[model samples]
Target: MNPVRKRRFILVSALVVGAATVIGLVLLGLRENINMFYLPSQVNSGEAPRDRSIRAGGMVLEKSWQRDELVSTFVLTDRQGSEFTVRYEGILPDLFREGQGVIVEGAIGADGVLAAREVLAKHDENYMPPELADMHLERPK
Candidate 1:
């Protein structure tokens, strides 16, 4: 083969390998950072992946909230009545309360508890503050 052609082929092959390596690294990083959402039933039935970052959402079980210093523990119940325990070591959202909808991002431990990294409380669109409920306002036509 010609020397010039051989050098060009080598250069092209190297570029292709380099690009592939970069893409692989990017995908690996993303895989580690990506968090998946799951419901209580899915987690209870062994459908949710264990030891991976995930987001679990459900209603906060009544009388399940326990707070001690910085750590808070609670149980999340889905529509199907399946419940999962969650432990968070940070400040919870102000709106968080028993029976409220919440989504927690964290990893499911080997013991089947969610070790929450963050907690987000969800509210309905028609929700109104109790202090403002007494004052009714007319809707725009």
Candidate 2:
């Protein structure tokens, strides 16, 4: 090939490699920030990653909320009756209560309890949280 044509081909190849590298790095960064959402059943079935950050959503089980001086424990249940225990060490949201939709973000422990770092409560009847909505969960009748 002529010198000019060879140089053009090399430049195109370099541009393609650089673009691919940038895209790959962006995806790797995003993967670290992506917290996957799961339901109670998925947690109960051991489908959730044990040591990675994740989000779990379901209705707070009736009569299962207990608060101590520094910690709170509760059971989260889905419509299908699957349940998992959650232990949180911070102040819960004002709208949080039993029988209401809630989502907790944290990691599952070796003992099968979720150690929640954050708790979010769905306050209104008409508005559903996007994560729960994505799962198509229906509120209790």
Candidate 3:
């Protein structure tokens, strides 16, 4: 093979290999970023994956939101509106409210309950007023 042609070929091969390696690493790293969504019923039925981090979304069951100053309790629902009681120990999102949508991430316990370590609440752009977000607004009247 011509010397220049051989060098070019080696360069192209190295680039391809490097690109593949980067792609593989990116996908592996994405594992931490990826979250699966499920419902309370699915978790109770053992359908939700256990041990693997997952997100369970549902409406906060009316009157289900309870707390002992440390562990906050609430409920999640499915499409059919079926509800499940959820107890968690952590500071809830500002958007977390009754009848609001919420996602809990954690593992499912053998007792047919979802034991989560992290909780993420969803809200719309209207959720927080500009003043509230900027911390310059007065109390809602």
Q: Which lDDT values do the candidates have, in the order given?
A: 0.87, 0.88, 0.76
RMSD in angstroms, all models?
8.7, 7.5, 7.0
TM-scores across all candidates? Answer: 0.65, 0.62, 0.57
Q: Taking the tens digit of each residue's C-alpha lDDT, what string does model 2 give over 49-72?
A: 788978999999989999999699
Best by TM-score: 1
The local distance difference test score of model 2 is 0.88
Q: What is candidate 1's lDDT per residue for 1-141, written digit by digit as tens?
A: 699999999999999999999999998889734644677888899887888888888999989999999999999998577999999998888989998999999999988789999999988688688667556444343
How well does candidate 1 match the true structure, expressed as C-alpha RMSD? Answer: 8.7
Candidate 1 collision pairs = none
Those runs of model 3 whose alpha carbons end farther than 4 Å from true positions after fitting are 1-35, 79-81, 124-141
Clashing pairs in 2: none
Decreasing TM-score order of the candidates:
1, 2, 3
